[model samples]
Target: MVGRQITWISSWKPQRRTTTSNGRTPRYSHWVRYNTFYGLVFTTTLATLLLMADLIEWRATGYLFVLANRFPGTVALIVQLLAAFFGLIHVAVVCRLINYALRLRLRKASVTLDVLRTWVDMSIPRIDWDLPLRFFFPVLLVVFLSLVPAALWAGSITPFIDRTTTTGMLLLPSYEDVSLIREYPMEIGTSGPSLRTQKGFFTYSVGVQHVGNLLSSAASASSSTTGKRLVHPKLDNTQFSYIGRSYGVGAPAGLTDMSISSNSQVAGYIYQEEGYLCNVTCIYNRTSAFRLRGPVAEWIYEASGNLPDSVDSGEMSAYIGHTGDAIVAIGVAHSERSPRRYLALAAGPSYAFLNSTQCALDFTPHLFNVTVDIANLNISVVPANPIPDFNPQRNLTRTVMRQFELLSNDLTNLYVSLLGDALNASIAAYNMSRPPNAGRDPVSVSEEAATLAGLTNSITAMADDMLAAYASAQLMVGKTFTQKRDVQVYLYGLQFGQRVYIYAIFVFNLLVLGAVAGEAVRTRGWRELGRFNYLDPRDLVIAASRGGEGVAWAADGLARRHSKKKKGAGEKRKSMKHVWLLSDPDEGNGSLSIRMKGDGEGHVGIVVRSPLFPPSPDPEKGERGGGGGGGFEDGGDAVDADKRAAQREWDRRRRQKQRVGLFGSM
Candidate 1:
């Protein structure tokens, strides 16, 4: 009841008049609106800042980048503050827009004084729950947009949590730097080593294999991390792209198996990788049992005494390359075997053995594509090439194991040839001396193997993948001979997806802010927006004071007394309208009021007459006493006097409150 007092001009503090820069208040401010420009400025500023934050990614090299990295939490707080500021700007834009709308509605329509009231002052959290359905649409949207700043804060800050992937070029150990790998020691057994591949065979600066990783990939093509022969963490959170042929060169120094290779240190994620690894295809041949024995480059004698190298076999092995081929070689082997599904013939059980129809290899260099999980150290590798006989899909194998390839034309190096030859010899030796393929797949041994192989060969599951990734990790961990190359090092920062989401949110914010600002200028309402202050209840009270006698039935608690009948939906509520907030003008200087249809021109409203009631005599002017408000239901000579008194009390209370400066206490 205290805040509900009706207002009159008598209570409002008279605004002191002031001259405008144009020397006079213009119609639509002399055909130009100034506050419209102010609104534009606010929106533009918000847009620029939002865009700036988005563009500054991991690659931002200076102060901002460092600040975001070193004080991530602090930076995040600052971002939140900025978002709050953005909200403030948006609020101002919305307020201005509502005023312009009110002005338009005032010019074109007439209505009951429902007091559109701060767009129902809808921005408040709990003051009025009925706001949305309580007003006209689209116009309400301006008020609804008060939520924009908050929405932007939630939707835009996506990169803050993506700390594992700030991508930028860095100087790290590359393929050319291979000192990182554990060096193989001097070995003399069946280890791979051609005549030209002994100690000090090739001059390598950092101590061993020079080139590592990929072969013949296009310069612009992203590196493939799907090779079956790459060894790395299963849950990698980092990534990098190689620069040129900077990977290491040569085969692994007798390293065997994936366990000996790859690490899970905080180094980085190896998402995609390219390199060369060794693969072998074995074709099974059936044969009769007979005694045979020998090594590569020799003949195995059979039980019959005379037999060709291919036909005679308990076990046998042979090599195809002579000294002319210094780095690469081909070989074959034979072993007695028991088929998985054995068959018995009428001529006695026939035995199967890999004989003359076979070629021998522990492994050979072939192009390989790899995918690695840098975090968990799980590595997946696949041979990109197809085989002549083995059907991978036809095998019905669901599990994909690490696989490698045989030598391809892209590899022109002979430095690590010793390892290849060793692998070949080891396989041959296993064939001729070993009884059958039933034993675990054979692996070549080398004591010089300082590091275990990182990538695994699925066929034998016996040795490491001495391909590209092994060399890379070796070099990176060793941190030696690292020439600064523009390696695309992925660390911690925003990712592609986060950036996209932010972009979309920014666009939405821009469009809404821009429309509100643009429309204000277009309609020329900005000039008069400052004249109205709808947020203050004082303005509404003054408007109520001006309501004509037709609305007197609701005055002095009359509506409350008759409140039993409730109206809802289209049946309830109506429109009302504003008084000029004249703070900018002096007391003597007059101000304008955009009166509503229900308002009367004079301070005291004229009475309304309805046929339902006999008209009462007007209050005796000379007997007009201190205002006491409306008379009771009893019809009497005092009825008009009571009404005049009630109206006067309402006016006096409103006038008292109005005298206070609206910009200050109000």
Candidate 2:
């Protein structure tokens, strides 16, 4: 009974006037009429907010770098100001609408029939007629506001953001930045530096080497690379192009093996012992192993007497640039398990040192370099604020150990503050868009910003803490293992992967929200156009003009019920037509008859069959019976066997009948 009553109540449309049990008259005879203005305003406001939010997010993520190499922070500020101004207008409009609604309610006479009708026309309850809109609106809004933006960013903006961010990191000076001096180009075939003349001297090259993870199966694909397809050739393999040289010679040849050198340049030989693990040696032109036999120089021996591998993961390593030749050297017993992968430097003599020295350097406009110790959990230096009196030899251990807690706290606080400021700005804009004293009270802009900022900071802190915890645990684990086992190296890989996953999930959630929000806004437009649902007036009009059959089954339930039945009928008809058109009539047409006779159910039966496979009459039976039609057989086992043999013989004859041409008698 309740279902029937609900169905009856739900059958009323906006265009049809109806009254409730309380004698309340419907407005516009449809649900769309009642909620049109509310829907329109709400949708417009929501869309504006979404756009503003997107702008802020885009700016924050430095998405504008794809257009020009402008300062991202400046661009973000401009976007924020513009969004703020637009948000102000939005708030003003909402305020006006709220005022108008209040005034209208106050002026209307209470309980009067005319007033009641007016109220019904203007009430939010009008949305009830288009109940599906209500059901889907919130879902759409959530998706649009959150997910769609993320998707758009990912598809169009996020790549740019990532590109710029990554570029900033790679552009970090791998070698000392010295003033450039113009010099005449060296002769193409002339040698600049010879290792032979400098017999008693040793040189080391200090540079950053980037190792990448590539699947072993992709080695062939590596051969076909043009190499020049990226912003930085050394950083991205896709941009690499071969120089005129052998696989182990010349400019491109020597650089092919290394992704990024300490000087942010490519090295020729890249060696990886495992997935996402690599060892790179930077070279300029010559392809021969720098340490190998050369007329100018001789490498007595390597620190480990082997190619770079896990054993070299922690040793302080350097590339020696002597004259024109370069050689990479590593310390014999440097700690690879140290959290800080120290830079190798040589001040004087052949002896080189890998130092965990911290320097104040903004590696990029947005990124900073931080140096920390793995053994003591100390912050050697924050690049954002490097100490002036920094000395690696005498003060590194003392300074780092002494100021560890202070430096860590300061860095953590700074990150939190920056994130908080951004969040606060967004919340402020949100507040400016809400009507004064309307609905639930808007959160204080400062508080909301603070809350968001705290969360972001907490997340970053958690990551940092995890790294710290893992490093300490790894140090202990390394000591416990006597066979040069370093768990810290593997832990870093896992930690990096987890970080990527978290970022990916966040982006996914935002994309989902944006999509939902976009749909909600689109639905509002349909509501305004008297098309509350996809199957409403628009469908009927389109179908009518397009010359399709129309039915009275437009009422929701009736429409669905009849539509389902029609679909079933259509399917059944399609199946019947296919059967009639396709099945073959030939093989075993007499088999069923034989089986029936053998079973002693001997009544003559008619079986419907495909036109393509109509039964064939037995020629022998027809001739014997003298009747034009029926073929018959006895029901005994001997008869059955005879019939089966006859059927097999018929099959053999049929196969023979379809031959293309008679073979010449030979």
Candidate 3:
């Protein structure tokens, strides 16, 4: 085509189709009722939504939790009511089917009008207790029974469903590499590491953990465990402008709030490095292999500096004073020649006789358990144990001995005394009240050894807290700190009881769907047209006042019963039951009316066989026996022609009613 230079159509569009049509109007005939259609829609939709909700439950923290950071129980309850509204619609359809079954002819149908009224009210979801239908429908009972429990679930499920998020859950964390965990922060994030040098000494500021260890028994008990020099429970952490890092046991970093919702109170925790904890074990009343040195033999009575005073005596003791006359005493053990230094606690309050029992502190490593509560980051540290190695490059034994070395002498007793006292006050002896008189009491050797064993456990817990504080602070240093490792934390999610309610709602809707669908299917070909289908005031009045005569007795019986009169058998609301269907005696030609006969004293026959589906009339049968079928017609004067005309009209009415569908429209 290019060589021949032929003209070709570039674009061809399809012809537009016309929506307008010119033909006879058509009427739609639905096989199922409108209420039934709505019910099916609601039930199936709710089921799908429930399944979807369950599948994505873990992620609902950011989505469905719109109203409050906390679980919105009121919102959930409101949503449940909204879903139940659809079930209410289906229930209405079910009530209609039940009414048809109760009033069916070709069988006895003698229910009181009050029973009908009660069921109609129940369809609207009321507390009306109709005695007749009470035991008939189990599904109806569920609505009443579940009310109280459903309300309780709405209120209680919030706290029950509190949950944690980890790597396995929907939202996962990216942990910073902790390969540089060997590095330690010597000071808080603010101070420098260098000591001012002079010929006398290279004087430097000690790290927080060192200064914290120097606190008295009571002060160190609370402060040192949290890496503070003072016991300040309300101490605020550093914000973004200035980072705060603890050298002992405290929050390493106070991170910016990263919660998904402003209302959400999310808490997170991360893993930290292993810590070197001091555990003391001593054999009470045991003799030592080594004797005291020449210079250490004579004990001096010195006043207690910063170390704790004896709680019973309420006075300070010297760091190395003889146990008999000292507030706190210290005794150096096997210090003459040993690679690992050991401090003994045999010295009493005055003369090699501190009241404290014999104990030796040993260093060990354990995993740290650190917790960080954010949305306002709060830190908490718990014990780490189960005896394992932390693989440290630095020996905590040597570092601790040097840090607490006696400044005046080569003695190493003062360090262990403070460490033991701090832990003993808080955990080992655990007498926060400092109850007195136990010191004077005699104790067995086993009791003495048992006392030191308690100190071992205390050291393990305190060490873990210290490690958590140290490792977290390393991250906040922003200088030498390098890595972080991910850990599990608590996050908002669904609870077991909450899930149970959701599944229960799904199942309830299924029951409603099945009930309504079953009723619709059973009556697909049958529709009660005319006044038989309605229960409104106008319809009930027309049925009661059959043809042109008023239902004067019905109104009179209600009044008379309340008036305290001795009424006749058929003059009460309960006594009047008889009703029969007949050709509309009103102006309308092809309608039906249910009427009471002679104040309901006369019994009536009920026929439920549809007029359209009635058996074909045989010519041999006497079909034209009744003539001029209006009430009290003159049968004797009727001719054969008028009788035939009446039968012919009845046949046409029957054909018209047959064309109606379940929804009562052609």
Candidate 4:
């Protein structure tokens, strides 16, 4: 039976093939003729431009470069590790896609070869062995170019982000409890002026009058002294009296009351100590007859009151007789024997009358009785005449009279000389008891009085000075004090290596993120397989066809069988029918045989020559003539060949259709 045959001729021409000077097309395309140079240049330029842009952005931000420069070794190590990790993933993806593409191309070539063998029974004449290199190198170049940004990002920018973020987090405002110490000296003393003396005197007089009158007179006296007094008095006899106590006698009647003058200013008194003094005076408003008890001598002597003329209750007058001639009187009289004694005595009644008085005055009467032996003169005066029944008044007047006599002797030369020695001794003792340059001890009233007593021959000056000094000291001792307070201060703001570690971590994380992003962009969301799919199918097919022996044989058969051939010369070229080749290699050399099938069978068969396999032995050649063209003639063999070819063709057609459908969907 005759089988129908269908021939397939390639409509696609190989553009890379070129004819040589021998007028024959070369088996393989020239390597340099492919337009890979432009692709290589374009890809390289694109990569370089992208790298430059990345560098520009890095320079504009400046942080990455700065950090890298600051810690180059550290940054370089970290960047290398990061690049390695990303490069591994990139290489794995690229390799996987390239491998998959290679397998797919091989499978496609296998299917095409199966189709040609089953339908046409032919193979190509030659294979382009360098095809795989052309396809693979371009893919490798593109993949390599895509990885540049990822590597750059990993090396730069990441560390800066980490460092800045960590530093910010660590830099916060905080506080701590603290204590502080400080030292200083405080001056504790009186705030105002230095203390001074307030001096005055008092007097009392008793006459032949009612005791009630005396009490009333005392009650009428002023509470404090009113007149000015001396600050520092000299020890002299003409200015002060220290001789005897005297009383008025042989006066008018009706003076029946005892008068008292407390704190009266005494005139003609010499002050021999510092601070204030009080002298008492009693006035005889009415005369009363009085008598002297001892040493009665009638003599007129000037009596000067310590008060001013305007405030004095009475004028200076002469006293008649005096008694109680104490030894102090002889000393004063001896010291007053100078030529100017009378002149001083004449004018001493009015001195320092009223300079101005401070209202805040304190009055204290300090009385001291001091006695010292003098080698000047011996006084043995016995009272010549004495009045027995004339008792003196024992009131304020009597006390003033006695004090006046004592103070008078205090100013004597002998007393002054002795008092000076005593004051020098006291001062020397006080100085020896204290450190040099130390301040004086606070002087109390009693202390001041003692100090004055050591210097004065009378107790009044001692008492006054003691009272004033004591009051002043009290005001000075506790003038001010010290206390403690709290204060705020700043310590440290940041410490330790916290800043270094925080910045390092922050920059590291940021760099990693940048690396991921760059990688994603470069690989188009990590779709490496999809990216590799952009390789040309023709290139892949040629590579597959070149690499496999089965595909190479199929290509060779197709080239040889499909080429046009010239007929013998001089004979009219008979009309030639297009021939198709098919084969069944499973039948060994017999499988290489072909048979014709009728039109009713819907297939054609042709025997093709193969350099790889020997021709099959023909049954018709044995019947007709042996050792001739070996062609198959049995209907059974034809039937078997046709059946096998039809089965393989069907499978090839199905596979081709599936491949076409898949391509269409894509």
Candidate 5:
């Protein structure tokens, strides 16, 4: 191949013999073809540029002008529309041709005299012009039909974004409404080590347990008592990425605060100490902790509404467990007819962490008020107690429970507002201000910015009104924010018609392209069938795994059965095998747990294993196992079961990693 390539190169080189002391002369035909092709390319390119500029100007000003004033009449409109259509078609044809020629050149031979000569000879002056005619004719027909009065039917059209906007939600009336309602529930993946799974959920992250080691002296008098050995689950020594790690109070006593540092996904935290809650503020990233060293403390006093027995002009001091501790202070409002009763929750090492937790807590609560009865409070605790070694276990429980109750109520109310009528009203009001427009319209940046600014101002004003309503409610119920509300506002406004037009265009283009492709396939037969042969090579492994026999039984979907047969002598009739099926057991108390290596380094799973396994001969093996493996009296070794569980975890992690890697590459 190298020799052939060398020979080819030698032959292809321009000959010096034909150009003795002078450059070779250009052929007239070559010059003519090159000029003609480039002239066409240049003209098409100029037309495309002009069309784009015109469209943009039209969108900006909501007015179309081609060389000054051209009034809106069917004739002038039709001509302009036709020109735009043909111009777009011209671009498509040129682009496709360029792509095809480049591919051909790269895959076949380089530029050659024979190839150039053939292109010139075979080229038809009007052949590339077919696309313009095709695009223009259909557009012209549509325009003419549209102008007919009969075509203007009065059909109600659903707004475009309605498809993306989830339904059955009540919109929040205001920011204070957000505080009153709960945010909707979003599926959150959990993380951590030493977490156990039961009924499909992993329950732990940085699991905290108080350990007391007591040394007993030799007994003298009556009878001697030996201390029983205490045991606690070992923490998993795995630290996944911040996106996977779950943060909790490392220590419950001292200045126990949990915050996300700057370098990590966690931003900051505010936590409780062992004594009277101290509210100190600080800024932090990942590595270092900076005290709210700001001359002014970042602390806000929350009113407990009780005058201390020792009164030294005490304001509503936040119960910070100890001095110099940072915690999130959130107001919780419950409703009878109107949302009234309020409670404040404080627990954090930094504001950011507190805010995020507050947001997470608020999600479910905010949504509930919007959709259901505000009086109904359902709390699902993520059972991770703060570091219990420093603080008395009893005090820790009370503080944690109080914090959870207050936070849960706030979160629920926030979620309810987001999903309730308030959101719907907001969307409706937003859409009403601006309707969509189709017909190859153009947009202007300055005009759009002005419109957006006006909308933003209006939304701000509305939000303030909402806050006032909440404040009034708070006062009536006897409570308020200690450091006035500094609420962050977000506003969304979308043009309905334009979005619809774009969506319709996309769907129409897809259908038309598919039809064009089908027609092209029919016209060309199967000559280019090799183009679709590409595959990932990973999918094959997935398929094989699914196809394998003796796949792990999950007691869901397809069921497996054992076959039994009777052996007989040659003279006797042969007995056929009968399949014995084990029906999937009903949902029972028995559980199945699954843990993955990279997935928060913890376990997550559902329980479906049955309690019907017969007792094993080895009693030690039967009761020595844990969870699902121990539910049945199987004589399986504990280590072996653990190994199997670990392997399953590894598989799950591998699959998750593969998915993430694939998406990243995309």
Candidate 6:
């Protein structure tokens, strides 16, 4: 039985041989040739889709992350959920495409195998059962690996988004409205030397005598028996300047003249001799310039040596005497000017009266009395320039003169009234000293003298009080000073939230890079088709044929079952086997032939035949049977031998070609 089997296998041939008119062995088709070409397109498209999906997910997640910081907690949660849902959809679609590609590869392998069998009598390779598992597991592993970076990116970016998007939010617990105070100390007046200063000490060289004195002197002369006697015998035209004199006191040196010291005083005496009377006025016009100390000094200089414009007008006790006695006076002054300094009369009736020409020219015998009354009494001080429309010099002169007249008259009357008893006593004493008949009262001379003495003491006391008041008002004219201090104000500014958002963007970009890298690795390295080996159909066929007669028969039966349906009449015929005959044309009269035995319908066959030497022609029949001149014929040992030789040559060439194709030129 074994020997018969061996012989049968050795004699086995294809049912039909197909060949071109010029016979040559056909090249074997490469396994996976079509699959590789198409597979590359499929994989590229899938990878692109996956990359796009990842990019979209990355962008969507980034947007959601920003919203998570800006919106309220519930709203942010909803946005995050929507993002995750969409992202999952994208991932699912990509995974599905990957799965489809894997399945397509398996199907293509089966299809290719079948197609290849029609051209070559060979088995097609089958994909390994575990291929799908291998592909899926790696994809899963890549996804898992991607998650590490994705999660890290997400974690890193969340805080950054929160910080950037929610920055400056009023709801933050640490948010605060803060105030800052700033203080600036300012000095607003000239500090080095006062405009009224000359060398150093306060200059009292300029002064103004009371106008009341001049008026009083004039009155006294007018009431006296002496007709226009000189009131001040010591005065002379040479020793004084008149009010109209160019060089006189208070007269401007030039049209644009500026006085070194504004402080000035005027005093004069009236000389009445006979019918003509002369006025001799003296002016102390120079200031005792000095450095003013303290905070108000600079202010004083800045204000042009005058009190601040805001100074209040009222009566105040001020030190005016050379002995520094506090006397009541009316004027304007600021508390901030100099607290420790004596109150200097800024402007008042006293100051005007002292500076007036009438007072300067007055020569009343009771001048001291009138002045004492004015000093002890409260009076309104007319400002130096009280009204802008009126001339200050003229108004001041008129006002001071009027006040002086009234005062002088009133004091004279008071003195006259007070001296009534004394005068009466004097008259009586004079009568007694004279003839008895002279009408005289019996009054004591001693009593009369006592009354006169008391009156004199009272007058002296009044004079002293008036002098003090006048002195104080003259001290505070024309000086300016002020002090400055700084105050702080509160303001608001922006804080923390802006910084957090910047970091989130950075993290999202990192995640995008990771996703691209993972996809590249999966497509180019892990799921690469070349990495796995598939069973070739040709190898399968050879294995099946060598297994046994039953295996070979079964394979043949299977191929027959899958054959194409019968063709139309005009269709070209089909064959299951391709054969080739190889020979050296130079060999003398050699011939080759091939044949196979099989059922006429739906069967496969193959044959080959060759002859080494040409046979001679039969002279009687005139025919050649086993040489180049003869064609293929059945039932001949010589034809069988020729078929065997051609088959062997074809097999040798096919093996050589396959070896060369597989391992390069060998």
The TM-score measured for candidate 2 stands at 0.18
Q: Give one digit per residue, the lDDT tens place, for model 6 in 45-149.
A: 433443453333322223444454456566535535543443343333333334323322432222222222211211111222222232324334545543343
Residue 43 lDDT (model 2): 33
Best-to-worst ranking by TM-score: 3, 1, 4, 2, 6, 5
State model 6's lDDT. 0.24
- Cα RMSD for candidate 1? 16.2
User: TM per model?
Assistant: 0.46, 0.18, 0.54, 0.19, 0.16, 0.17
lDDT of 3 by residue, 1-666 (tens): 101111111121112211224311111134333535565575567556655655565434545444544556776666466544544555555555554443332112223233444434544445434322332243356346435333433332332345556531111111133333322333456432322222111112222333443333223333223232322221223431111222133333343223321335344544443455555454443453222221223443443211121223222223443332322333332121232334334333332322343445555654446555544444555446644643333333333332332311222252334443453554434332223554455752244343454443443333333343334333333224443344555666543235666566566657756765676567442332111322445434433333222112222323433344325544454431222233211111112212221112111211112222111223454333421112212232356675456446545654453221111221
lDDT of 5 by residue, 1-666 (tens): 101111111122322213222222221233432232343343334334434433342221112222213343543455445434533443333333333342223222222212222222222111211122323243344334333211111000111111111112111112222232222122244321122222111211111111010000000100111232111111111111111111121111011011112111121222211111211111112321111221133332232321111123222333222332343333322112222222222333332232211111110111110011111211111222223233222222222222322322222221131111222233334333443441234652333333233323222222222222222222222223111211111111111223333333334334434543564466342121111000212422332232221112322111111111112243453332211123332221111111101011111111121121111122333433223332221223447666456435534543342211100111
lDDT for model 5? 0.24
**Model 6 regions more than 4 Å off:** 1-87, 110-140, 145-666
Model 2 — which ten-residue stretch has the worst lDDT?
A: 202-211
**What is the clash tally of candidate 2?**
58
lDDT of 4 by residue, 1-666 (tens): 011111111221334233445432232233422222222333233334434534333222234445555686896577577555544444334343334333233222222222222221111112222222323234445555445534543533234321110010001100111010111111234121222323211111111111222222212211122242222311111122112110111010001000111111110111111112333221211121111122223433333322221121322333332322211120111111111111001111111110111001112322222110012111111122332221122112122222222332232231122222332354344333344334544543343333332222222333222232222222222112111111111111111122333343334334434554565466443231111121334433432322223223233333333232222333444342222223212211211222121122111122221222112232334421111112212212345465345435533542342321111111
Question: Which ten residues in a row are the worst by lDDT in model 4?
Answer: 249-258
Candidate 3 CA-lDDT value: 0.36
Per-candidate local distance difference test: 0.32, 0.24, 0.36, 0.26, 0.24, 0.24
Better of 1 and 6 by TM-score: 1
Candidate with maximal lDDT:
3
Stretch of 10 with least lDDT, candidate 1: 340-349
